[model samples]
Target: MKLKLIAPYLTLIFAFLIISCSSDSSNETPVDPKAANNKSLGTAARDFLSAEAFTGLHVEIAYVNGFKPSATTINNLRNFFSARLNKPDGITITETVVPATTVGSLSREEYVKIEKDNRTVFNAGDELAVWIFFADQNSESDEGNSRILGTAYLNTSCIIFEKTLKDFSNRIGGANLTLLESITTQHEFGHLFGLVNLGTAMVTPHEDEQPDDAGVDKLNKHCNQEDCLMYFQTVGNAVGGVMNSLPTFDEFCLADLQANGGK
Candidate 1:
């Protein structure tokens, strides 16, 4: 999803309706409820990492019919969150089947419509909710052989191009489907946790430099360590751009998370 296997790196952006739920004294302007569940990416890092604000984590995994992620992947995701998050209350996941998109590829608007219509979980009480959709098609952001696997958009929302991911996983020399799913899921989840200097500031300067679509240098919001899960390896070079095995967060990432209140 990071780079097109051909030449250009497609940038996929999703703009969700923003709502600030925090209420100030009766003196400040009113907050918009319509913006509920939507916040800037990486803004909810502390809430997910630390138990200070949210003591429990609820993940809503909604998928297109017949495209539900494997149980192994789900367990892997749960384990990843449980290992890193300080949510002592508990971490839970709920899966639901949603209608499939009619399109072969999905645009930002299509993504928004689907999520708005089906997503049922949002941050409530002492629990922080995370929403993830498993789409049955490729992202409209795809170009050439570069197919998007997943994208983390709003603070608590992400979508996985499940069909495309499966296709790639079944490819010759591709990584195991479960491993690919687990890694990709964890990677997107890492974004939600604000990895590699995203929302959580880095203890050291380790953000990797990647070129934009125009070949311009930019902080592509990934880790510098190739062995880290957040590293942005070019899919064009790797077979199907999927990892052969699961990867752990590099020490720098661990430091960032710990500094931000994560275990």
Candidate 2:
């Protein structure tokens, strides 16, 4: 039987900036306190990491609009996640690749609308899913085009813009697109796991305390560790710096994850 699509009960928004600097801190909008306190985003991370969460978990990676990831790329992501999310009590990670298709051009709002409309394609409570869109996603603001690498809705789904990643890769001597994509995928997932000041309580004060020109907190939801995968300001040449070496969760990040029952 085909699964029915259910609209997301709660949509948690976490935005990532690809540029090294933001427009203005004053423009930074505050997240709703009520939404921040919502248990769905917070508890989802805890439940996924808990030994009793599920006997097995499935992660579906769908490539839309001509986005085709290589076999090596797919395997690398699986290996990276298995080492971290795997459990000793017979928990297993299964991955399936959805065939590539042309979904046509889409703006940021359109992409989001499509995800919400077809939410049933994802197993809702049954699976962890991420959709990678290779098409260009333009912003309505003056930032022009390709300013974000990806964004993840807590426990719901992750949307990645490959066109931007490929553009960045070409600027840097045609670097490995797969590596960049992997870094982005993992970084966004880190947010879902409640890194920094997100849902998970931080163990250390690694949060970026500096404010932007507008006086808004610069590290609202990102790590301050330059070498960690969850670090903010990972765009343009900064991406290469982070990808120069393998990205790993810093001590503070690991502490938070461990505290929440993650490996």
Alpha carbon lDDT of each predicted model: 0.72, 0.52
Query: What is the number of backbone collisions in each predicted candidate, taken in the order shown?
Result: 1, 3
Q: List the residue pairs that clash in candidate 2.
A: 5-120, 25-214, 26-214
Q: Candidate 1: misplaced stretches above 4 Å?
A: 1-36, 234-243
| Candidate 1 lDDT tens digits, 1-263 | 23222322224542221100111112212113435467777788999899999999999999988888899989889889888999999998988788877876887667767878777777788989888888898888775545566777777877877887677667555557777677767887888898767789999999887665589877767788877877775222233443466788989989999999998
- Cα RMSD (angstroms) for every candidate in the order listed: 8.1, 10.2
Q: How many backbone collisions does model 2 have?
A: 3
Alpha-carbon lDDT of model 2: 0.52
lDDT (Cα, tens digit) per residue for candidate 2, span 1-263: 00001111122542332433221112112222223212233345664555554433455555544565556666766676666664444323333333342454444455545544333333334343333333344223213333556666435345666666666567634457777677667766676666666677888788765576588765656678777777665433344443454477888888888887778
TM-score of 1: 0.84
The deviation in Å at residue 199 for candidate 2 is 1.5
TM-score of each: 0.84, 0.70
Checking candidate 1 for backbone clashes, the offending pairs are 19-35
Candidate 1: worst-modelled 10 consecutive residues by lDDT = 17-26
